[model samples]
Target: MAPIERRSGRKRALVNGEDIEKKNTLKRSLRQRTDTVKKEKPSTDKVNNNNINIDKKKVLESSSKENVEPPSLASNLPKALSCLNRVQPGIQGFIPHGLHSNNILYRLQHNAMGITRERSLRQAVVQSYSDQLANYRILTTASPFDRRVTAMQWHPTLPTTVAVGSKGGDLILWDFTKTEGITFMQGIGAGGSVTHLQFDTTDPSFIYTSSIDGKVSRQDFHGNNKTVFLNTMDWSYWYCSLDVNYRSNVLVSGDNLGNTVLMTRQGEKVWSHRLHKSKVTHCEFNKQCEWLLVTASTDKMVKMWDIRMVSGRKSALYELPHDRPINSAYFSPDCSRLLTTDQNSEIRVYGGPLWDKMERTIPHPHRFFQHITPIKASWHPIHELIVIGRYPDPQFPGYHHGENRTIDVFDANTGDMVCQMLDGSAKGIISLCQFNRDGSYLAAGMGLNTLIWTDVAKLTTQGALSVNKTISGIGLNPNRGSNTSQRRRNRRNNNDDEVDKLKKKLKTKTKTKTQTKTKTQTKSKSSRR
Candidate 1:
């Protein structure tokens, strides 16, 4: 009995130990499960918090959108200054041109309704001015310099004072208003061959000049009192172009290595940027929108920038690509259109409110080559017409198929040939030309000489020569006497005249139906007919 009891007690003790281990195992499993739950609680909370932040952001966006003004209210407010919103808040204080009355911003809203009346008035003025331009003839020709003429500008206020620059660093101020005593004074080496010139709008007595000598200069109309406004002394870099904004008291200049620098009128540098890859051939500030700037580069690009938004290597507002190097880009008189001349035989006009869109493309050959002045189409000061020199290519279509070289004036809107300024005296390529501020006169630079043309009827000036008359023995063509092209043109005109005369005679001598047909018609026809 005792042995049996001992075996059963041992079995009971082993079973009890097993039961104890199972209880421990169960407690450990429970603690592990609780620890996992605690660890996951913060993670789940974090996910919920992220969801809440997303909801808040969406709601804020919706609320902001809802708070926007209605279109009706927005239309009543000004539009031009709205572009200022895109600029940094701190920049508006420095650019005062935005508030000037002459700029477009100070006027009624751009693209506003009921503006057709203003447009109609402008069109009427253009028509009257264009009619006067048709009667224009060369007033005189003056040799301002012995070097090739590069740039020219008329005084902003002085009606007859004109500034001319040449490739050999000559600046000439000519007063053509005098009929008897035409006077011109020249300064040598103002800069190395002034490439661009602009008369100060605020002070017409002063003029700004950009030159190939890496300098920008401000001087008097007499080409005296020159003060260097900006200079890039590096040998590989020189100022190729510059523009001044009188209202803002700022000047922007671009160099050959694509560096564009902004400076105060007093010659303090504001900022500089590498705006192009190659040479910056042209740079202009929009007169109407003074904050806007345009630049053309030999890298086959024309870019527009809102100077306010061009901060720290930012991209341009719009980038226009060209098939070839661009000669120039200019804003129209109204600043509503942009014109660009490219070497690949294209002249493009871009219109607003979005200037990026090309409105018209005029196919004209103004070739780019060495040893010739670049032909850039210039805008008429008062009319919507453009003038450019016709490249001397016989294959290109022109007046007499380029045989009689003439400066062409094209209607900007329709891209139609408006008029050809053909003069027997002004031979050779008229590479550079610009209309006076009044649009009453024009000056063209042709091979070291400047030719002035004016309306004889309007100006009432004496000694206005006919287009066919040579001026001071300077109008003779080098190949005029025995040139095959000239002979061919003369022969063609003669043939046309002879043909017209024969046609007139035949028309007058029509045969009548012979009533007395038989003998009289046969016998008298030999003598009387």
Candidate 2:
């Protein structure tokens, strides 16, 4: 009976434990269901709000479309709404249907209606001169004794000193550093229109000027003493260009009749060569003192001469043929190239082995054309750039009706077209273009005004400077020293030595033959006696 009682008590305890576990499981599942319902309630509310807003938008859009009292207003609403939707939130207010039609009509009327946006954009670009204009400043302007200024030169060593020549044959020196403004250093009246002027590389104080009055005059800038270097009256119609070999004291002058005369600084004539059948336009000297002279005539031909052998009276080393009259010729800064501007407005470059051969003619690059009659051309001192100035076409007369006076710059080495500047507003033509000695500034001479341009900033932005301003005079300041003079004297002495040796050899041979003849004559006289 005691064992039966213990087994019944254990069964009763096990049954009570199973009943508590079932009640705890039911409470936990009920709490989980309540928490899930709390989370799903907010999600269901958000979905209902979204459906209501979508329905409202559709109703407003449909209402606006159906209320077509004003046809134009209704037609423009969709476009305006589309544009408004694309606008960012910070821009304007969100619009409803009542004001939407009016707003659409306002926008449609104000919109660039009937205008091609592309055409308007192109017009804006064309009218924008924001990047094209240039800033120019005048440094100094020194008027000479005569109002007709023909030529001017800056001192090689002093930037503030300048020599000016007048059409009245007056050479005036002006000191720019003076407070009295331009103080006259000296005046030399050489009795001719000073057509051309240059300073001696060896002596900056000594200046040379040539005139159409048939005279080449040399003057000391500090002293009033003047010397007539050569009289061109007997040689030709007028003296057009003058270049001096400061190291060799050899002066070369070109005349209107295409005659080139080589003379010593002491006024001894060395040799003369007739290069062109027409007028000789300009002349230049290379570092080797080899002469490069160009002649142009109404006859339409430009000739280049290598006058290094002219001391021996030889013909020109080279002659370049042209179909039109050459107005100007320039030797590049390297002295290895030549540029000739002609009446046909073509800028031709001649280079290669033909530069050395006197008779060899090489075909120039054909694609390079200026297309306007060029009056003057200059080369950039440090770059392979050539700048040319154009004149009014003879076929056209006035400024408004005539061909535009233009300036063109080209890559001299590769013959690539770089930039063009057209002056349709100006009245006169550009007469000359000159690059400063450092090549930092480019000066152009027009009718009565001189234009000076800073080259660095323009080249950085627009690749080149525009040719609109007028320039009447241009000057380059280069430093000269005793070393330069000594070098020139040494070169001159070497040339003198070569000539002396030839003369000495001839004298020796003549004496030897004379002695031989004397011996034979004495022997024959003794036999006769």
Candidate 3:
């Protein structure tokens, strides 16, 4: 009986050992399956976390590379930027005006809230115009000359009429109102190129052309008759720049020999001054102040002269010196500021009343080379904004490695880049750009090709309101301001809101995914325990 019991106990022990082995094998198989699942599918929380980090890095990199300030960031962020920065920070509540707004403490405390009424009004107007900056579609393209286009101008009174002068001494008068387009085309230069073009102040039918051959020609509207208006006579000197004052019908021209000649509409020289040691690159008369004349020169100086106090080279009324040769100088629409572009990488703004001090210096790339025309900064006809052709430099802020050269618009007051205008039609460097009388149309000259852009919204609304009047060139509609401004504001706000909502949704989705993953892990661990 003992032997039988011992055998039964041994059998029982063997059965228990088999049960233990079976449990171990099941655990091993389950572990293997779990390992394979883990290998095939990572933990969602970790994966989602990695993806969020990657997305954020990509967003930051793209933003830095593009150099475009997203409206969400620009409008919502509290920035400690300079007071001169036109971008207002996202500050809540009313801010008191400070006596010294430029002080660091005031700038930190006010964040653009301490702006004066005049400055506020000016900025408001500039902002209103800035809102109209949509991508200007290429309205038209034309090859008006055989050689490079050096000068372009829109008729002061005729909205559709434009004149372009070429390096081959060729002139083309184009009227967008006509189907044939070319109203006049002529070669008015004897041996040199046409340097500048200007329209007569009182007569839209007459135009002025200056040539490197030392001749300024006046042509009738039809281009049938050309009269040699002003001949420098000394075949050595040539007119380089020309501008006419519409108020007084007084014309001003700069010559390569550093002469700034003021003339009457009758082609008689009022006075000539040796304004610079080098060639005069640009001469302009203030549209608002007829007697105020400004001249830029290759001698690295910009000088302002009041023609009323005219004398021989007896020092300019006010002079702004530069480190590099000045390419062009222009007065603001209100004649309260002067904008000058230099051959090197600098653009300067001189404040008005007394033009002695340089208000701001904006760094820009405009290296002068032989193949390209000198880049000249121009003023928006009605706003406190500046426009200039951008030289393609990898180091330039908005320039990409392989992108086409663009036209840059800047805020004259704040010295901030406002926007860039680019299109497929502008394949070459846009060396010249000009705004029409009311600033509704813009024309740019690229090599020999001419590109024109009209405000899309303005054109559309005008077409819808009075198609016949628009076609007939009646004028701008005065009643379209309020609704257009409101629409622009609404669109801008909607865009910002949409971008913000998308960002918020992404953050929420990540949070939800992480929370769900954590909860699932906790439940699985509890069940295992």
Candidate 4:
């Protein structure tokens, strides 16, 4: 019985030990599970925080991109106004007058505001005209047989008279103020189309005309005499263009056969030279009688020639090359520069020293498309501005389809475009355009109607004061007026003159006083003796 009780106690002890082991195992498993749960919670929180950070970075990147774009139209207003103020600061609130058309006769008064101070002050039309039908007063008209009026010119001295040249070779002179049909002057057949016409600056009655037949004729408006100054037979081909100097003694003609002829008043060829591979389009003489000839050819080259030394012989002093065929060329008023227009609607300028090497070549600043071909170019008489005439565009039809005749102003110094004027309704092509001697009037011949733009006063004033200030040192300070410097200069000159006169008077008075004193002393000495 004792052995049986001991075995039961051992069995109970073993069972209790197994139960304690099981409890320890359960506690260890619970701790392991708790530790695993803590580690998982930290990893989940880290992933969620990283996602929030990525979203914030994306938002910042989007905001930065938006800030980098260009400013909108509304934002540019201040900048544009600032630029305008910088360009024109004087006379605040001075509004510019609009160009108004009264019938086809547009009267433009040359405003005195823009001229350089040294030039003489004159009020003239930067543009004016009269035509035949009397539809437009103060304009010139075409003839019965005239296909188109190619060129027009007013007598340099006779302001009331004007001459019109047509494609039919007829030269008509009209007293613009008269109500009659016109005072027509019958001249010789122009041979081909008349390309250019000019009144002799030296002789008001003498007029010159250039034709495609290679003939340049001089006609006396006062008389019925028409003399051929130059003919194509003298040169290689027909004279396509020509110009006479202010002296009226020398004539320059450009021919279709790439030849330039320099002739005298007696129809004698002074010199002849081949300038380009293509037809010579235009020729002109500088103010000093130094010649600058421009020749445009099918070769797409415009050659500049200086013939100052070879007035008696056929030789060129200098030649310049261009990329396109030039249709017309004009020299600035000072003759320090030249401008050439091409068939490609491009205008180029070359600096000049009469017969020396060219200084530089500059392209026209205005953007002109290929469809708008420039046919004629003329320089303003007093200002460094140019007028370009665009020929009819073959692609476009009807009035709207035609090339709009444009007159653009450029800074002769910087070649920067300043302003542009256009003819909205006029059709046909502009064959010739000229600025009158005063630079206040511009005359243009279009098809059957001759259009004149008068009262160019705004142009005269637009840049005149600024140019004057720059050149003459006027209006430099806000407290000082333009007359201050001028008055100072005048005072200095007057003081110098006064000093000179005082010195002269002192010498004379001293001589007279010395003579009188000498006589009195001699008399006194004799009396004392």
Candidate 3: worst-modelled 10 consecutive residues by lDDT: 467-476
Specify the poorest-scoring 10-residue window by lDDT in model 2.
470-479
Model 2 scores a C-alpha lDDT of 0.54
**What TM-score does candidate 4 reach?**
0.51
Please give the clash total of every predicted structure, in order. 0, 10, 0, 39
Report, for every candidate in turn, its global Cα lDDT versus the true structure. 0.71, 0.54, 0.71, 0.55
* Per-model RMSD to reference: 25.1, 29.8, 33.4, 27.1
Residue 449 of model 2, lDDT score: 34
Identify the runs in model 1 with alpha carbons over 4 angstroms from their true place: 1-132, 179-191, 221-224, 312-314, 394-402, 456-529
TM-score of each: 0.62, 0.51, 0.62, 0.51
Q: Write the per-residue lDDT of candidate 1 for residues 233-287, one digit (tens) a residue.
A: 7645688899988767789998888889988988898889998998899999998
User: What's the true lDDT of residue 200 in model 4?
Assistant: 71
TM-score attained by model 1:
0.62
Model 3 scores a C-alpha lDDT of 0.71
lDDT of prediction 4: 0.55
List candidate 3 stretches off by more than 4 Å.
1-125, 188-190, 233-235, 246-249, 394-400, 456-529
Candidate 1 Cα deviation (angstroms), residue 385: 0.8
Q: Better model by TM-score, 1 or 2?
A: 1
